[model samples]
Target: MDGSISTSISSSRSSPLRFSHNPPTPRPLLSPTPRLTPASAGRQPSARLRAISPSPSPSPTTPQQRQQEPMEAFGFDALKETFSVDVAAAEARPLNVPLAAPFTIASSRLEAVSNVAVRVELSSGAVGWGEAPVLPSVTAEDQPAALAAVARACELLVAARSAPLGAVLQDVADALPGHAFASARAGVEMAVIDAVANSIRIPLWRLFGGASNTVTTDITIPIVTPNEAAQLAAKYRGQGFQTLKLKVGKNLNSDIEVLKAIRLVHPDCSFILDANEGYTANQAIEVLDRLNEMGVTPVLFEQPVHRDDWEGLREVSIAAMEKYRVAVAADESCRGLLDAQKIIHGNLAHVINIKLAKLGVLGGLEVIDAARKAGIALMIGGMVETRIAMGFAGHLAAGLGCFSFIDLDTPLLLSEDPVYGGYEGILRENPAHLQFPFVNVLLYSYILQL
Candidate 1:
């Protein structure tokens, strides 16, 4: 896909894809690919892109910068104005789920993640569960603020439950604009989507369009000491994980040491180096240049510079590709469709990380479709969330059938599974044949099926 590269399979196995019946787990492979996943397929290039209207345009510097461009309407605003979800009642509670271990990134070291769990009761008494992982660094929403936002969205959901589902979700968006309590909006959207799917007796992936039944995912290793990273890498590899995400971006030397350690232990594993917006332009260049010197070529280089440093982002991306032929993906710099617009228009990255928390389910679909049409590689990721939210994200990613990378490892990282009922099993497992005796057949099928 242009120079925006992502590894993918041609076609899936001929076996009939079943839904909601858990089968015996399949054999794991060194490659984290499903039997028949057409990952990152169905791209539609040459679709005239509707560029976003990013706020506060920069002062003009050249003739091209001063020229006006056509803006494409993404229908998100219309969807918000027509929301309809009959919510009989809605409830929210503070959730402080302790991680099994501390997850360290460049910005913060966290022993526990605080979130808000929501239960939305539909008029038919079908309750859908959702959780919002609140992080100021990621969603600009703290626990208390996200809880309040969820509370407000519940009120709006109750008021407009009779509207269409999209309209009902749109109403929530209208009530909270400009990324206000984004995680909260995301949680509400997911719960409502799950509730609706359960009511209709279908999997969440089918609710979106039934593109695929399973998704393959990679495990993450947070920034840590070389020994710890190498140990974790080998441990994950032994557990059948093929792809590993190395959280880097502090000092160049330490990062190199950690990577070298992992490589020395498990040289055959696939690796993605995520800098988490911790390095400067020059620093990022030096580190990558050094990586090249050390003979390490990661599958992808993610967010090497600060989020707002768009110029530096492009420079690093270009430098990485030109010097080492490595692909670069954007994470922190891409908040929503608008940021995506700026990135694509400016040629900032090879891949864009799409998190459902930032772009609610509907918007996520639209953005992914747009990115695919634009020929940009796509990655579906999640915050450190439980199985509830990330489960839905995994189904959506699989349903889209065009994601290049899958990073739904948050639940694996969580110390406890506070919520369930979404897709949960090994990457090699075909959950469609799995039996669920506890949940209502319809409820379990809808919630658990792909």
Candidate 2:
């Protein structure tokens, strides 16, 4: 309901969607990452990082440093006033986007993700996009349920009271009480926000006060052998990444060995060990103790115990903090504001990882504000989402300049780039409108089947 942004939404649900447990065919990792090309980079000045060197820079890339070169070189102004738009119609666009490679997390192995997207058409004839990656592992909501939730949410927006863009999106979010389809509701919310922000002729960060315009996020390494983990860490390090998130929980000893392998290869890089609720409280404590003996501590220890084991979470967190002086964060345990409150009030976590799927732009902001009020740290994160969702999170992380942690690096794992523009440098406007720079990279054709 903030007056800075304006838009409206809602429509009837879509029909006959299919859900699949089968993973999409994995694409080979061949395409180079999408960066601003001189001809296509917009005519605008990008943000810059404070100080960066060949050596590991603690700060991530800033807005000015986003593009390979500079936006001014191409003369692309992302904020150039396009046209004002009154929301006309909103529709759900679902696609089972294939991953460039198979990604194995603690929960399961995924060859592709079901990306449920929302396309908004405005009165000015400008179409805006918003997307939420559906992953049962993260939000318990799958593709069909997510698409249906967006459809139902859109229907409510059609009849709701009209207001500013932010407010309308908030209303759209409110329509889904108890987060019946939390991620799906978020898709609608983001679509509206994206449309309104773009329509206003400014970056989404500016609408949010444009506090900080740059961010650096940690790339994740799923459970792998110690040797593989080390080799992977070296590759990411060679790519100039300074932080690494290693997935733990399969085997405590093996996880420790993985950490050791990475540490041996890249000693200066910061690390975040995420157990994905794969460990018991005692196991979590034991690992931390063992790591302390190794004399190297992670930047943070995430979700060390089962999602519902509040006592276990608190025990490990407190023990890690008291004994090892290491901070602990809660991911699966903290979904929205209520969980955030419990984490803060109950002192269950030193930090909270706010992923957009679990909390849309608005809901994510509210949670960030709550964490700030309580002096708890935040990590702006997202699923293996394309530029759409990560773009939104990056804006907030850079604008607010508050998150001590960021995990918006999943796109690096993808072999394709499905979105053209959203995040400043992370995803740029590909002048080729007909197709993404990499064919089928950003295009979701399965959406048309509906």
Candidate 3:
């Protein structure tokens, strides 16, 4: 009926198969069956035929194929280009006064925490600040040596055109293989990252991928008499601390009495008992069982026994899980990922507490990842440090969301923190309000001028 149909019909009329005069009596009104080609009639469409075939993939170029890739591609080079530490712009500051006395543990008392402030600057005029309070007994060093080591290392790295922080550390470690101080190394490393992050204007937590913003940290009430411990717990509780970590390792009875006293005032606060490697496996079990009977369930028992006693640790872990339904955490026993791997392979504990001071920041991150992959719960704990170091630890805590507990009470333990407002000082009198005479005028002047 349409012109196109007429054209088709006219064309068909010219062909040999077309009917002429009566159009073959006009076929009965019916739908025409589709004609099938010989190639298609005998076969059904396959799944392979039904699926969409993508265009042929382009072959990789020879240069791309030859490039050697890092095992874990972190976009590290991008980070390096993004932020570089400037060695010459480094600075240091002195605390208002030496930290207060009677810094006691269950086994020993400390007189002072010699504090030094460190700052690392980038070529772009960005600066990162850090604080290192020398803990001679804990880190096996004194204040002067630690400060000198840190300054010397900072100079060495800066003179080398301010290499990537990791490369700088590797170079320093390689150069001073047997002489490296753990505290000094930690101080410098933290300052470097801080400066770099400041230069890039990114929060340290976001740099690690939005793991956490604010984490609830446990406040440690150092070992004291039962009455004193109760007062300290009440003070911290009044100040809005929900979790309390009691130092417990000198005398089991004294520790129990102290725990009982604190419980009387604040029964709802969660507790973590840190023995600091003071008990034997048997002693740990006895103390834990007694605590359980007293109705004070610790969220975790940290380093109940000595560091090297793997057998003791395993036994304690099994006993704690079976008898008290409590979990054991390994602290001093872990040094790196390998240490974590060994402990996990042996089932030494239910959780692993990672200290960035013990394992360098990057190394600590690796260990955390390894522990997570091995199905162990993680805790981020810190040594006694300044707010600068605590900032680094806080970032790590925020990055790793699985951490069940955080022990970042360093600021709460320091008697005087030079940085002041960012963190709460331990002393009743705020250290920022006090001014001290020049104990190190030359160093102070040099840093201030920088």
- Superposed on all Cα atoms, the candidates' RMSDs to the truth, in angstroms, are 11.2, 11.9, 26.6
Q: Which residue runs of candidate 2 sit more than 4 Å off their true CA positions?
A: 1-85, 158-162, 424-450
Cand. 2 TM to true fold: 0.76
lDDT of 3 by residue, 21-127 (tens): 11111112121211110000001111221111111111122324424522222333356444445565654455333333355665456655465566776677666
What is the lDDT of every predicted structure here? 0.65, 0.61, 0.57
Point to the candidate with the largest TM-score. 1
Top candidate on lDDT is: 1
TM-score-best of 1 and 3: 1
Model 2 global lDDT (CA atoms, 0 to 1): 0.61
lDDT over C-alpha atoms for residue 234 of model 2: 85
Off by over 4 Å in 1: 1-17, 21-84, 427-450
**lDDT tens digits, residues 1-450, model 1?**
012111122232223233533322222122222222111111121212221111111111233542443222322234334434578988777877677678998877778768877778898877777777776777888898888888988887776638777667777777766565668878887777767666655555544444444566677899889999999887776555667888888777899899889988888777787899989989988888887777777767788889999999988887777776677789888888899888888888888898877776666777777787777878788888866677677666654556667777776676554442344343232211111111111243222111
| Per-residue lDDT value at 191 in model 1 | 79
True lDDT of residue 122, candidate 3: 67
